[model samples]
Target: MPQPHQADGPAQHAAGRQLPAPRTPSPRDAPPLNWGVIAPGGIAGSFVDALHTHTEQRVVAVGSRDPERARAFADRFGIPAAYGSYAEVLDDQRVDIVYIASPHSAHFAHALQAIEAGRHVLVEKAFTRNAREAERLIEAAGERGVFLMEAMWTRFLPHIDVVRQVLDSGLLGEVRTVAADHGQFMNPDAAHRLFAPELAGGALLDLGVYPVSFASMVLGPFASLTAVGEKAFTGVDGQASIVVTNESGAHGVLNTTLFARTPTTASISGTHARLEIEGDFYAPATVRLISREREVLDSYVPAQREGGLCYEAAEAARCVAAGRLESDLMPLDETLRVMRALDEIRRDLGVAYPGE
Candidate 1:
């Protein structure tokens, strides 16, 4: 087992045992992967900034309906080429994979298009409008022998890796209860993206997913779920609270909102200790692990790098070069499982999309 000294290390198995070390590939073992960008949006900007961290990755081109928009994005990020439409990038033989950042409603379509065009995909999260849409992309990717992964960027962050490590070490004892929340105040205008039905806008698909994903990360799939959500006049959920229970009786509480301020906090409690994550729990930040003795152990403090978002881009580059279709840490099954949980939560809350 690694001492407290290796705080960023992978979680060791319980009983003071060491888990297997990560096997690194030699130069002879990996292949080249040239990446493309589809839908130049705000979230894509983060990917653009983060992708610069990897020498192994290249953002060859960008595609959008508005040619000028695509060119401007390319220029801002130093990408080499821009296309007038997504179809062009999908058809580009030089591009090995595509990172998608369209609206939630378009994730299914965009991912399917990329898969059909024989390109691997890293899709932005909340993978789609619902589990059904997510499963569609997954099935198509499987059939096409192409890679498809949800861009659950938080799960790939350095801090989250460290969090997983701490939990597995048994130093926290058996995790008994969990809590996470993400909230923000969004304007109520129907034209705003948060309230626009056309964009598939709402709190649950937006800020809500992070806390829910965090809970699932710690607790795994819940055996049962219950939720309550407050809806906007536009009929979209403005806030939601969900409770999930594991077979072991562990309780997970998650909250998300576009209607209130929620501190954006998180914690995990166990027989021996508890961990309190600071503001912006999903990103680069600090967490305090408290013990029965009231001692505090902090990890992931004063991040060596800001905007830890780039780590996911680096991880994808490594995985693709190593011929991996999906990340070992963030597997396709896990993505589907999260979507399924979200789907059930929406159902229980009486939230339904236009088509549904």
Candidate 2:
């Protein structure tokens, strides 16, 4: 077994093999930006609430195809303006950035519109329907000179920062494998978004992206992957089990399903140690470092419980304030790479969305 290194470097461990403290800054420290939200959906509501409860940022406007829905969301959140169309939100002079919270199928078009309007954009994840859309958005953002980011909220969480520090510090020796799974039981109704191919509905885009992104974060880039999948009643992918190999020959075992609830846990194993994240690992949760002997060396618990969405918002706000086109933590290149990997998986599984 490989032994953990004792180094005087960026991360300083505690006495007796303790974990490093997370270097994440408070969300409130980020410079404030006026945000306009598109699509008053469930995720949007949570995002707006997190921003209001934790950051100095303000949501100046909200827009939806349905006027009453936009008005209701605005009133609920105390936002100043409610528009009946996404174009109205894009046209608002006060919006420094646009947050596109639309469904997976709509991410590309909505984010493209925001970029064309010269508004910095934060797109909800599974950034686009495929790698092609992701590339176009990145190119458009470059031409427009506006910031663009996929809101992969887990990447910005405090617990994840601790995991990053541990990996960087070599506490886990030669990292060999990463394993993660995310699954949720969804209704079988054909009309539900998860079952509709037109909406890009599937286990992979909606539920699998978490484990795939987590694996990408730990393993860098995918060199090759093999996938086995099953389809839902509506012809959308219902589950997938994928094994990926990175350039360094490290392996990532990932799984996702819409047919059952899973542990949703994740673990990274190395020659000397392993780090395990609690269930619902994509959100704020406990992280524990274990030794080769299976002894717990250290553990970390997050300070906040419910409003974890604010961290990603704060990251976007900071990036825009610093005149950046994308975040260092979740770069556009990585986003495209992940999309390519997802595309490969979909192809292997024979899962195709309607109209590309």
The lDDT leader among the candidates is: 2
lDDT of 2: 0.93
Steric clash pairs (candidate 1): none
Off by over 4 Å in 2: 1-16
Point out the worst 10-residue segment of candidate 2 by lDDT: 7-16
lDDT of each: 0.79, 0.93
TM-score of each: 0.89, 0.97
Give the lDDT of residue 265 in candidate 1: 87
Candidate 1 global lDDT = 0.79
Q: Give the runs in model 1 whose Cα sits over 4 Å from its true position.
A: 1-32, 53-56
Q: How far is 226's C-alpha from truth in model 1 (Å)?
A: 0.7
Count of clashes in candidate 1: 0
Candidate 2 per-residue lDDT over residues 212-278, each given as its tens digit: 9999999888888999999999888999999998887889999999999999999999987899999
